[model samples]
Target: MAGNPQGHQEGAAGAARPVGVLALQGDFREHVSVLRGLGAEVVTVRRPEEAAAISGLVIPGGESSVMDKLSRAFGVAEALKRRIAEGMPVYGTCAGLIMLADRIVDGIRGQESLGGLDVAVRRNAFGGQTESFEAELSVPVLGDPPMHAIFIRAPVVAELGPGATALATLDDGTVVAVEQGNLLGTSFHPEMTADYRFHQYFLQKVAGFDNGTARSSRP
Candidate 1:
């Protein structure tokens, strides 16, 4: 499906905005390519200090447990928490959603997160890798024509707290995408396709725009 080019209303001309992709694991390269294609400078973030330098960050799809281990091992976990608390825009795909979540269901013991979104995500809610599939999603925030979503052993937002807004969902009403303040979480991988609306939305609506524009706190 063709994406709406005008989905982003903040500033189409991507100038100095440098978006970062968490390079610790997963499909970070694909995200980097997409961001660069959108005309924004891209940065590969592997360290906490590096994470602080970018205007926004993308956590790609990968094993949630593995990502958690790596983030803590490399000291990126705490740093990310600090950044998100400061209202830094961050988008997470698949396991990325697991990382941004404040609550996780059936997670490993001692598993920690950056804790931005007030949602409960169940890992592998769509079953194993073999159960992976694609669907056309109607994301109202990005406007018409529906976006193609790629789900690979994806997690699902089983329960959204008072803070999060449901962006897209399955036909059965399973929450697949959510936006909470400057944080965006998707169970599907937007980097896997040609459509760039999701990334653009993050840049324009969350990253470039300040804290005042988004929900300051949950009501």
Candidate 2:
């Protein structure tokens, strides 16, 4: 079943693209707010059918295991796999990052993932909520001035496959963000903050340009 982008109730004039947030469970509203603030049409995607019409998808931070089960139950998992296979742009944060990872270490038994990024992530590598912390990262792709990253029981990309490119890292060199093809994954919550550069970069880099064409990769 194809998605209904027209079903969206909130939109901005000259919206670059309709971006869907997997609304099954998570901090989805925060993502929606950020996308809308960036002048993009926002849709809350619950069923697999809703995954079709959007130009890109955002999987927000939540319980990776629960999100996985919900995605499968709603049939959005298969639909998402198809769209991503067709080169649809996707940005995942926290648990969303876990969903896009090819492999996850210490994941719950039978916990499944959508899998696109060629990287291995260890769930809650940053420890529990008591261990949650924040740091300033120099993400050159988003320009200087350092991006503030918040970690809440966040996972860390333990290793990258040949195709993965590290975008941000801890001062000690731990990978926190990465990109592969049309997909972007981050271990931090960009939506929870006021900065919109990461989302804008996703639009410019992964979701294609305003003219509806993929942007040429930065040299």
What are the lDDT scores of the predictions, listed in order? 0.83, 0.82
Displacement of residue 105 (Cα, Å) in model 1 is: 0.4
lDDT digits (tens) for residues 39-158 of candidate 1: 667789989878766667889999989999999999988998887876777899999999999899989998888788999999999799899999999999999889999999999999
Across 25-98, the per-residue lDDT of candidate 2 in tens digits comes to 98999999887777667889988768865778889999999999999999999999987786777889999999
* Model 2: per-residue Cα lDDT at residue 68: 97
TM-score of 2: 0.88
Off by over 4 Å in 2: 1-17, 206-219
Q: By summed lDDT, which 10 consecutive residues of candidate 2 come out lowest?
A: 1-10
Candidate number of the best lDDT: 1
Q: Which regions of candidate 1 are displaced past 4 Å?
A: 1-17, 210-219
